[model samples]
Target: MAGEVRAQGAVKSGQLDFPRPLTTVDVVIFSILDDKLQVLLVQRPAGEGEPFPLSLALPGGFVDIARDRDLAACAARKLKEKTGVTSPYLEQLGSWGSASRDPRGWSATHAYFALILADASTLTSDARWLPIRDGKLREKLAFDHGEILASAIQRLRNKVEYTSLPAYLMPAEFTLPDLQRVYEIVLDRPLEKSAFRTRILSADMIEPVAKMRRGPNRPAQLYRLKKNSEPVYFVRTFNPPE
Candidate 1:
């Protein structure tokens, strides 16, 4: 259910600390199809500490061993249940195992991040696609979500500079300029147009489309994401870069 996580293990305290066994998933969904970078959120229905009858949150749930063969698949299934769509790029964010992170005893959760298009009717909660800008998000995102969001953003920004993650958000075919924009968005700063072009072109991950997207003056070609397209290199840092 979408309620509290169940507590597990025996406590010498005598009083029952938590109820049943507990496990959870924290999902971070993002899409970049246009000018904006947006994340999916859902409103909490009434009665699950839901102050707002409809408030924003990520789609997630308890692990269902019966339905899913493994933890990752279980989390993915829960995400689909809550969001109404399947995630194309899902990965383990990290394990959140704590003695008392959950109100229920001995509870733990596994967080996962999903990358998808920013569209309607697909997010988990009451559902809304919120822009990444701080002011754009006024409502309180639920359950350690603030932290989770921050982590996902930092992780994404760091990944895009030299990695192919940008491909995850772009169409199969895209122009070098289009791919560059996604990179700029991730960097949170503009890259010199010429240098940007060289960076991606040299990587050689994208190709031109058969047809072009004609513009006001001339024809602009469309391109698609490459297969198994790993960027030339990744920035490695044991610690978060300053």
Candidate 2:
């Protein structure tokens, strides 16, 4: 019962003994670096005689009802406390509850997925951002976390194909190439630059700004999502690389 949650107050014997399954939250936070996708993981401390002295898993913990007003607040608090990451694009992925998902007791988790800019400087020493390749992660994560992560990855891949959700991963102003890189990273495929440009432009999800990003080479024109551009659904699903 390592991560089990107890009731706040004692239950009366004659009262209706309602089963209150322990509620918790888990976050799968993703970031992009060098056109590659990465996910943040926190190290779980080793207990005496455990086979794995240390293991990695998504940043999460039991929900503190007194401190957290809701499930999302608990997730955000745990993410910041465990990984020092805050203020990213977060969305509920799904609920996970199985008879044997947790070793402790009956538990239900409201899992979330977050998209953030890759910045190692913002993370704690115990937190790491690992690459996502071959449609999977390299580390042997703890508990049912691997399944949760895979679910989040699939959700992101599906969403990016139809929705303008990926814009949350970029800066306030970015070039088309930059946006394409975000897509390529999330989808794990090299996009046809011209075709990608045409598709994105035709959708009119973004608008050109009167700004340019200066670099060693020529300045690149900047663009941002239109303030009132509605998300387009039912588009063609993007194909992943073989």
Candidate 3:
């Protein structure tokens, strides 16, 4: 009799449950390429009844409950599937959902942003990097992705002011000048060299490698991010060079 009561309770709850929303995970992958901060976008497959046929969109897909253990897993899986690259820095941005966001049905999406080296992986033809000029995109994106991308750019720029985020966009080994160039590209301003060097060194996020990068003028010391190093948060934001 107790088993029957439990089954009846389950049925009652099931009947009361509202319709589930369409769930998906999307990732914004950023890299430095061509002296600009670029984002990877994939072309949506053209298909009959496709919502955004032949349009570019952020890499993402519906969550696979059987395969994805959680949102982050789903995000990493989608990132690899779309870009053929895995990022060293990935963070949850925010969630977006609405009845009007998707034409198929009520939909909700979990968004994540990631930083990667441009040369880390070869991108498939469907995926390509587009330059983000002035923290904005020129082309329209599919499925409300334009708004999502804008939010990601804002988040990344805001975090870069005080965090060691630009480090993830660097190659395995680089010089201090190389690292500073990346910071300027992302922040869209030049930082005081002495001040920037002091701040970065004091953070203890990177260590000098034995090797050096030979350049035209002279050899510069190469440094790599410390193993298992997390982003170092500075107490103050970077100020533009006077």
TM-scores, one per candidate: 0.77, 0.83, 0.91
Q: Is candidate 2 or candidate 3 better by lDDT?
A: 3
Q: What's the number of clashes in each of the models?
A: 12, 0, 0
- State the lDDT at 161 in candidate 2: 75
Candidate 2 local lDDT, 1-242, one digit each (tens)? 32233353235774644456667899998888666788889888788754234789888878898999998888888777755667767789998987577765577889998887765337878888889998799888887889999999999887887676777778778999899888877876777888778778888778899989899999988998787645556466555433
- RMSD for each of the candidates: 5.5, 3.8, 5.6
Tens digit of per-residue lDDT, candidate 3, span 3-109: 53344333446575445678999999999999999999999989988899989999898999999999999999887876667656889999999978888777899
C-alpha lDDT values of all predictions: 0.66, 0.79, 0.88
TM-score of 2: 0.83
What would you estimate as the lDDT of candidate 2?
A: 0.79
- Candidate 1 to truth, TM: 0.77
Residue pairs whose backbone atoms clash in candidate 3: none
Shift of residue 233 alpha carbon in model 3, Å: 0.4
Which predicted model would earn the best TM-score?
3
